[model samples]
Target: MKDEEIIELYFKRNERAIEETDVKYGNYLESIANNILNDDLDVEECLNDTYLKTWDKIPPTRPKVFKAFLAKIARELAFDKYRASRSKKRGNGTMHEILDELEECIPASNGVEQSILGQELENIIADYVRSLPEREAFIFLSRYFYADDITAISKKYGISKNNVSVTLSRLRAKLRTRLVKEGYLAS
Candidate 1:
């Protein structure tokens, strides 16, 4: 089914909307959840929560890109689950590694001012990503947004793993420079 049709089903309050959405995006959403959460049971729980969240969101909010909408929900839920699980016992995981990589460029939300600037920071980062070359942007998003590992990104883009690391390092450096210029980070 097309995205519009599925969205209409959602608007009409039909349960089939969730089914069709699952049919179209289950594997993709599962991959996103799995990337952040390597555990199968957590991934399944996150996916179920994602569908429930989507069902509640779509009535009032019709998304422009349905796939991206679902992806965002799934990612957020997965991150939440990952955080909750880690809070019990601190451990190294994919999400932790991803955040460590981005910790240099992205500031922690520690203060009220920083929290207020969160949306602006997001916009700045989005604009910077938009300005990158296609391959660079793909690599950036694959690692950061999708929480993909270096090996996965390297294979997906047909580049050496070392090259992927180098590209990500350079991208992070450039992002830090941009953030500094934008006053999100002190130079």
Candidate 2:
């Protein structure tokens, strides 16, 4: 079902909303959860949590973008579950793994404090994303923010896996340059 129809079902408090949401976004959600949790059982638990979260949020939320809404909740929940299960020294197998790839261009010591206002951080990141080519920005956010896996991102964007990898490589390079310019990283 389309996101609009699914959202309508959610607002109507129809139980079938969960079933249809699963049928439509289950694999997508699972891929994201698995990327963070790296365990089948935890991924399953995260998916269930996502459904419950959507159910709770739908009545008063009425999201303008349903899929993005579901994804944000799922990603945050999955990451939370991963963090609780592991020590800070043990991070999940996520795009964080690749962050080191750009650390050379922009040293990690210059990181911003997390307590900064969310909108401020989003605006900064939005400006950075806007500096990228449209495809590069989309692919980068799809991988990192959306937590989409390589294969699915390739399929969704109608590009090959290798193409996605190359585009991401270029995007990361550009982002590092931008980060340095924005003073988020050491020169």
Candidate 3:
């Protein structure tokens, strides 16, 4: 089914909206959850939560890009699940590794002022990502946004793992420079 049709289903409060959305985006959403949660059971749970959240959200929010809207929901749910599990076990996971990789480039948020800066920082980063070349942007988003591993990225692009690592390193450096120039980071 087309996205508009699915969205219309949502607006009409038809439960088939969830089924059609699953038919279209189930595997994609599973991959996103798997990347962060890294467990079959957790991924399944996260996806269920994602669908529930989507059902609740779409009545009031008609997304421009349905796939991206589902993806964002899945990612956020996966991250929340990961954080809860991590806090219980205090174990390191893919999400932690991904965040650690970007820790230098992104500033830590503290109080109200920092919370406002966080929103601005998101725009700054989004603009910077948009400015990157297509391949670079894909690699950047794969690593950071999708929380994909270096090997997966390298294999997808048919590049050596070392090359992928190097590309990510340089990209982070450039992002750091951009943040500094924007006065979000002290030079």
Candidate 4:
């Protein structure tokens, strides 16, 4: 079923909306959930939660891009699961590693002013990403947004793992410099 049709079903409050969504996006959503969640059971739970959340959201908020909407929900649910699991047992999970890498460019300090600046910082980061070349943007999103494995990303892009790391390192440095210049980071 097309996204519009599926969305209409949701708007109509039909149960078949869930069925059609599963049929169309199950694997895609599962992959996203699995990336953050280490256990298969956790991934399944997050996917189910994503569907329920989607069912609730679509009536009031019709997404322009169904795939991205589903992905964002799946990713958030997966991250919540990951955080809960990590609180019980530390270590193990690509989400931590990905965030650690990003920590370099992001400012560590926080205050009331920082809270107010958050939206501007997000816009700066978004604009920086938009300025990147297509391949760089894809690699960045694949690694960070999707939480994909480094080895998998290397193979997908036909580049060495070291090359991927180097590219990300360079990008992070550029982002850090830009953030500092924009006063989001200390000099």
Winner by lDDT: 1
Of models 1 and 2, which has the larger TM-score? 1
Residue 58 miss distance in model 4 (angstroms): 0.9
In model 2, the runs with Cα more than 4 Å from the true position are 88-96, 99-113, 146-170, 176-187
Cα error, candidate 1, residue 119 (Å): 1.2
Worst ten-residue run, lDDT, model 4? Answer: 107-116
Model 1 stretches astray by more than 4 angstroms: none
Model 2 C-alpha lDDT per residue in residues 1-187, reported as the tens digit of each score: 7888998998999999999999998998997888777789989999999999999999889899887788889999987887577655666455455444444543433335644444554576678788777878888888777666778789999999999888877777776677668666666
Return the lDDT, model 2, position 172.
73
Q: Per-residue alpha-carbon lDDT of model 3 for 41-103, expressed as tens digits?
A: 999999999999999998899999999999999998988888799889976766788888898
Error of 2 at 183 (Å): 5.7
RMSD of each: 0.9, 4.1, 1.2, 1.9
Question: Where is model 4 more than 4 Å wrong at Cα?
Answer: 108-119
Candidate that beats the other on TM-score, 2 or 4, i.e. the better one: 4
Task: Please estimate how well model 1 matches the true structure, expressed as its whole-model Cα lDDT.
Answer: 0.94
Candidate 1 residue-wise lDDT, 100-159, digit = tens: 989998988999999999989989999999999999999999999899999999899999
Clashes of each: 0, 0, 0, 0
TM-score each candidate: 0.97, 0.71, 0.95, 0.91
Q: How close is candidate 3 to the true structure, as a TM-score?
A: 0.95
Q: What TM value does model 1 have?
A: 0.97
